[model samples]
Target: MEWYLKVLKNYFGFSGRARRKEYWMFVLISTVISIVLSLVDLGIGTFDEETGSGLLSTIYGLAVLIPTIAVSFRRLHDTNHSAWWLLIVLIPFLGALFLLIVFCFDSKEDNQYGPNPKAIPDDNAEIEA
Candidate 1:
């Protein structure tokens, strides 16, 4: 999907705002890939205790982790909040809950962060001939 690729292209970019569609699509695709990679690694005996995770698995996680954090931060930016809010996840319980609420909630309209991502486009000029 274009949304998924858009996020990947901006992989390390922590600026700008990301809509719910973009963020959720990336998560969905990443999760499916991780599942498939883990299964393949298991088949090839890459699940050995020595390395813990196979090369593919490690790569898969890193690939997803980078985008996940980046998008999450961007999502926070959409709420007019600093990316540092991500550090809340480091706290035991309360912090995690707070961050979850922030990420799951919709963005406020026209805040300092940016315009509401879900706002409908104006079609007033389109004459209904």
Candidate 2:
């Protein structure tokens, strides 16, 4: 929850790196909330079968659309990639698969994008032989 809220607090932030945990946690929670709102809209008869979108769901999606994109951009930054790479999503099927792979890659420590969000303390003792 903290991770999700942190992302929301920086709702329009796209200049920093986001840890895998923060990105994934926000996605997980948002998905769960969407599902719940969909059910509510269905009960209220505000769901449209034609478009497969409910009033509540649509409203929620619109509200968070920018934040979602912002997080995705930050996630890409964490991998040391440029935000322009997001255009790959327009390439049809391969685009999403490629992005999935990219987002799953381990964060590159202190890259041009920014510092690694998963950085460990340098003060920790090393396992010297």
Candidate 3:
């Protein structure tokens, strides 16, 4: 839950690395929310021919889009890749495949972009008084 909120707080931020837990947790929670909302929309027959509102479904998708892109870009940053790579997903099937590969790959340790986000800070390091 902390991770989910952290990601949301950084919703529009795309300049830093995100650890696997942060990225995956955000994805998991968002997916669960989407599923639950979808179920409710279906149950209410929001799109029923007689009388249904499409507004709720549209809002749901819009709500998730920002975090989705932010996480994906941060995931790429974790791999030391430029966030611009996200544009690749605009292509056909290949784009999504590429993103999947990137998201699944382990973060590079000490890459030019930055240090591995998965590494824990040294407890013995001196702190300024």
Estimated TM-score for each candidate: 0.79, 0.89, 0.78
Residue 33, model 1, lDDT: 80
| Candidate 3 TM-score to native | 0.78
Point out where model 2 deviates above 4 Å.
120-129
Best by lDDT: 2
**59-83: candidate 1 lDDT, tens digit per residue:** 8798768888999888888877899
Per-residue CA lDDT of model 2 for 6-40, tens digit only, reads 88999899998887877888999999999999999
Candidate 1: pairs in clash: none
Q: TM-score of the candidate numbered 2?
A: 0.89
What local distance difference test score does each model get?
Answer: 0.78, 0.87, 0.76
Model 2 error, position 23 (Å): 0.8
Q: What local lDDT does model 1 show for residue 2?
A: 61
Query: How many clashes does each candidate structure show, in the order listed?
Result: 0, 0, 0
Q: Candidate 1, TM-score vs. the true structure?
A: 0.79
Report the CA-based lDDT of candidate 2 relative to the real structure.
Answer: 0.87
Please identify model 3 stretches exceeding 4 Å from their true place. Answer: 48-54, 120-129
Model 3 sits at a Cα RMSD from the real structure of 5.7
RMSD of 2: 5.0
Q: Model 1, residue 75: displacement in angstroms?
A: 0.6
